[model samples]
Target: MDPTLAIPLLGGLSPAAFMRRHWQKKPCLIRQAIPGVKPPLSRTELFALAERDDVETRLMLQRQGAWELRHGPFTRRQIPALNQPGWTLLIQGLDLQVPAAHALLQQFRFVPEARLDDLMISYASDGGGVGAHLDSYDVFLLQVSGRRRWRVGPVKDATLVPDMPVKLLANFEPTEEWVLEPGDMLYLPPRWGHDGVAEGPDCMTCSIGFRTPTPTEMAREVLQRMIDALEAPEKEPHYRDPAQTATATPGLIPEALQTFTQKAVIAALNDSRSLACALGETLTEPKAIVWFEGGEALAPGQGLRLDMRSKMMYDADHVFINGESFRAAGRDARLMRQLADQRALSAQECAGLSPGARELVEEWALSGWMHGV
Candidate 1:
């Protein structure tokens, strides 16, 4: 997408303008991100998804000012009657399972895929809400059906209600409030306090969230990947200090060993290529619960598109997909990067890849990482 092109989804602001003015800086409420937008799934369909063991679902209700929360694979019988108020059901990762949801989410590609997370749908009955809370990542809340009222503001205190299963702000102070009808959307930055309550039954909201891994969390994953990539030799070198005389205090640490240890760590950390590979692979890693079904291998003339469950990314010298990394260069490297960017490659583009790269892609198709298009 052209950065300077004005988009209706961004409230008439071009992506460039929106990124400069509102992204992570403040909120922007778009009246009709998608005019006449309909929910990707009906209430019945959403409830059925919640019944699947592979789906991540949550049920929340407030009765007499007391809150209750439950994890799901819930039975239809377990769900409250439609007439019942004060209840909400949330289905996570809709884009991974639903074609319509995935297509809807594709519109937000202006944001880099590295930061992009999944789309979650929240269905709420009259007076239902999850309570006010702060999210650590940016979120775009789109009201797809029915009406909901949102109260949003900056977080003054990070305190949560004690003994609550869900994070509920103990004291929510709203400075901006709006009633969102179908097609309305709201954007909130990280740590911005917000709450939404269904105006009536059948209310459905879709949340597009972005991942914001903390430095320590990123370090742990990247470091682990880097360490795992080390190729250990069959024989290991042992530290020796045969020239040293016997010390009166054996407890004293040896300077030579400390220097060796430092050198070893520095050597490990200095592999810039390894570090880049580790980061790319880490970013493209799929969710723990995600798995793909095996399919036929890509034929010579067929184009290819990534499986919805597949995560693909590329760095300067490497391409990463589903937690695995491969060094890529030359013509094949350029085509692989194109696949990562476009999420698909034409038959002509696939034909351009070298023999080794073509074989690798065929393997991906057989493994269900990509499909013939």
Candidate 2:
């Protein structure tokens, strides 16, 4: 949960130094980044999860120069035989379902929660791979089982093959190569081309991806939130001009109205509480394919911790859990911030919460987002 925990894994580099020098800037191949790192789920367990309709999964098969992709909620029989070659199965958000995977993800908490995505597990047969590709967001590739041969480079040509299900780079040129054994990890910044092929049977890799919102996407979300704020009845304030000269050019937008709009926008931006709420909610939203198992409310005085499956974040004035925001203040704000930072509220901290905050925590527990400390 702190910088000290990362020392052994990062070759004694302080967390601050790692963040400043290497994070999202270049690549680092750390041998045994996680000592004795094992796959969170066994092959049978992973296959069982893939059978559930709620789990997001995909199967890709390449044979005889032909590629085929299939969506899953697959039955056991649906899985191809292990003897088959050139096939891969991917399960998204494994961390959300497995405690060990969740614990693994917490090791990267130095990065902002907003940019942290989820763990994706890929199970591949011998010679299986998704092909050479570049992602727009940062990624950490950790080898969990068997062996994988990886080739990587700074891709000059980002062009994709004309008609393929995968966004494969047409001109992939490898400048570096490595064969990863269990516990090895490779971190790559955005737009770095990489390809990995299973060296033999039963190769599994865990990919931790970061969120990268484009400017246009961010602007759209912010503008929509602004419009929603403008429409709130209690906050609405109309433009008023007591003395106005009637202009011959009626098509011109009224100066008072324009000024009002500009002020409204600025006001929205300046509202720390609102901005915090929006950012937190957006970051914690469940993936489209994710759902939760509702449970009973917590008893009073019970401590709380985030469900390993849930995402929570906070800012100075608000806390976000599972894509919803709550206005927070006073000791509640401090406590919630601590929870966001550490992902848990200790028994002592829970005892200090106000009755109102305690009630909210109980509600979150019932929603399966928080658990007893």
Candidate 3:
């Protein structure tokens, strides 16, 4: 997309302008972000998806001024009747299951792929809502069908209601409000409090969320990957104390041992591009529950595309896919980075890969991390 072109998706602002003004800064309500936008799946289709074990689904009900929530692999009969009110069904990772939803996500690629996360769809009945809450990640709430009345604001008080299964705000104050209709959208930055209620039956909203990793969580992943990449010691080295000196305090850790442990960790990090390689692998690692089905080998002259479920990324010296990393440079490095950026390679582009790169591509294809275009 042209960075300077005014986009309806960003409320008539250019992508560059929107990113500068709204992204992670404040909220933006765009009317007709997608003119005449319809729900990607019908009620029945969405319900069927919720029934799948692979899908992450949730059901929330508000009855008699009380809240109840449940995880789902629910059947149609398990869901409330269409005539029912005050209930909502939330299906996470809709982009992984619906091609239309996935295509819709491409529009938001202005954000880096590393930060862009999955799309979630919520189906609600009349008077239904998930309750007043805040998220740690930024989100775009798009009304796909019917109408949702939203009350949103920055919350200073982040306390939650006790004993609630969901993290709901104990006290919420709205500074802005709007009733979003089909094709309307609202963008909320991380930690902004918001609540939406279905104005009528058949309310469906698509939530586009970004990944916000905590520093500690990211450090753990990167460190674990770095450890995995490190070579094993040739022999188990025992702690040594050739000097005839004993610790005055038996419970105290020896200063020599502390220094040795620090040196070992630093040495692992000092290994050739180990930190960079680890970051790439960690970033491209797929969810634990995600699995790929093997496919037939690639044929000659076929184009290629990364599987929707696969995560592919590259650093300066290495390419990473589905938690695996490979050293790459020269023409191969350039071609692989192009594939990572575009998420696909044309037949002509494929022709330019080195023999080894081609073999690697075929390997990924056989493993179902990518497919023939």
Best candidate per lDDT, number?
1
Listed in order, each prediction's TM-score against the native is 0.96, 0.90, 0.95
Worst 10 residues of 1 by lDDT: 230-239
- Cα lDDT tens digits for candidate 1, 118-233: 99999999998899999999999999999999999998988999998888999989999999999999999999999999998899999999999999999999999999998756
Off by over 4 Å in 2: 4-6, 229-272
Candidate 3 lDDT, 104-152, residue by residue in tens: 8888988887897799999999999999999999899999999999999
Candidate 2: C-alpha RMSD to true structure equals 2.7
Q: What would you estimate as the lDDT of candidate 3?
A: 0.91
Best by TM-score: 1
Supply the global lDDT for candidate 2.
0.85
- What's the distance in Å from true for residue 16, model 1? 1.3
lDDT of 1: 0.92
